[model samples]
Target: MTLEKTPPASADPSPPSASSLAWARRRGSVARFWKEYRTHRAGLLGLAGLAFIALIALFAPLLVGGDVQSVTNAPGTALEKPSGEFPLGTDQFGRSLLGLLIWGARISLTVGLLAAALSVAIGTLVGVIAGHYGGWFATVVMRITDWFLVMPTLVLAIVLATVMSRSIWTVILAIGVTSWPTTARLVRAQTIAVESRPYIERARALGGGHGHIMTRHVLPNVMPLVLAQTTLGISSAILTEATLAFLGLGDPLIISWGGMLQDAREAGAVSSGHWWYLAPPGIAIAFVALAFTLCGRAIEAVLNPKLGVAR
Candidate 1:
């Protein structure tokens, strides 16, 4: 009997590890998501454009060096029209417009991202709390939210930015605080809808606490909405930042698209018909905003087929 020898060794090893299984599932989910996303031509184009700009922004220093922001060492004469020496022309301070545009992207994109993230984080937190614990707490939060909703967001942001020290963080803070009410309202509505589901009740019955219900159940369910909102919010944030910068509220030291516009205005570029001074930054802003909007709409459509992607 012993000579019969043991059965052949198992052809397969033990089941995949928990992490491995999870990673496999995530990989599949990503692939499926991408497959759907690819169907949106505008989204793909927008994504490509944004990616290219982001790379330029990411490598600004290496591509053009930091001295581009320095007026004292500008490579060309002030407001020189675009030519071989300076393709995008020069700003009022004689800094290369091309270099300023590139450097500007880094700061502008960063502010947009950070401001959007801050707005979303606040909104998500308020939404989850209000949704998970309804009654008096939700009532109070919604009341406050309603108050904010009724106010003019831009006016409020301007007020905050004006009162606070003029800096990048101030701009971010102003944008973040003033812009979150819409997201909070959105998330709250989604949360209320999500909690009405049967699984929420089951989770409650299973001894789940507020934290567990909110983080595990509510957040995941509402994440698609949050993500779409975040994407859209970035465009809004960028526009807002530009508005602020144009109004001379942005950080003076930061060279950004908006700042370029402000500088051009100060230099009488607009009145003088020096289109070169203003066109590049203006186009960049419009293109970047359009790209974010496209990606945002695509994501919303992908997450919820009811909202089809715009053509």
Candidate 2:
């Protein structure tokens, strides 16, 4: 009986499928990126701070009543110092500074994100078209980019804002149009490099059209640069928004850090030593700028490990 019994035939198990392996590789890459990014203390701190600020902005309605912005029924005295009842004190109109700061964060962050997105979109389009379809087209595009690059971004933005209607969208559009040249130059260089790769040539040989190649290959390759540029651009956009507001180009109906500063100046905060009025907004602006810069640096480090090593 023992001799007659034979082991049942077994089939060999197949290895992981190509798609599964690829998915696993992507997951591993993301994990590695997170691990590496966590090592950046400044970046982590900045990210945490940004998260806190964003939460405050997101929960502003729940945190503070709408009456906080009311000039007629203000809950505190104008320029009151920080107190338990009204932490961070009140603005010239007796509005709660804490509430104003939180509300202002929504506007500031919105402008920064929207303006940077618009700038990046325009820049990426210009850069890819210029780089992919080189020669005369590229020359013209580069000339345009150069013209924008050479001009002071602030001046251009100021001019645009001055001509446009005085509104939030106007500020966003002004900043968007004026701040794109730098991103254009960067993306163009990266796109050119990507287009010259052997894979791109192979893709061309495989009957891929310009649109297919650019969308499938070139865009993915240059996305890292675009992402980094966008993060960095947000900080610049926020600063610009503040500048525009301070210069009286911002919407007059909203509470913004820059508007706060402008009010402080108009109220002679400097001479009166209303440090409470000036310091909060100034610090808020600086804090946001530093946070974005730090996060941008970390994203760069993650995308280019060599950069992290160099640092």
Highest TM-score among the candidates is held by which one?
Answer: 1
Among the numbered candidates, top lDDT falls to 1
Per-residue CA lDDT of model 2 for 1-311, tens digit only, reads 36687898898899999999989998998898889889988889889989998998888888886666779998877888889987788878788888888788888999999999999999999999899999998999899999999999999999998988899999999999998988889899999999989999999999999999989999988998999899999999999999999999999888788988888889888998888888888899999999999999998988987775333
TM-scores of the candidates in the order shown: 0.95, 0.91
* Model 2 weakest 10-residue run by lDDT: 302-311
* 112 Cα displacement, candidate 1 (Å): 0.5
How much does each candidate deviate from the true structure in C-alpha RMSD? 1.8, 2.7
Lowest summed lDDT window (length 10), candidate 1: 1-10
Candidate 1, residues 5-103, lDDT tens digits: the string is: 678877887788999998999899889999999999998998999999999999999999988888788777878988998998888778888898999
lDDT of each: 0.91, 0.89
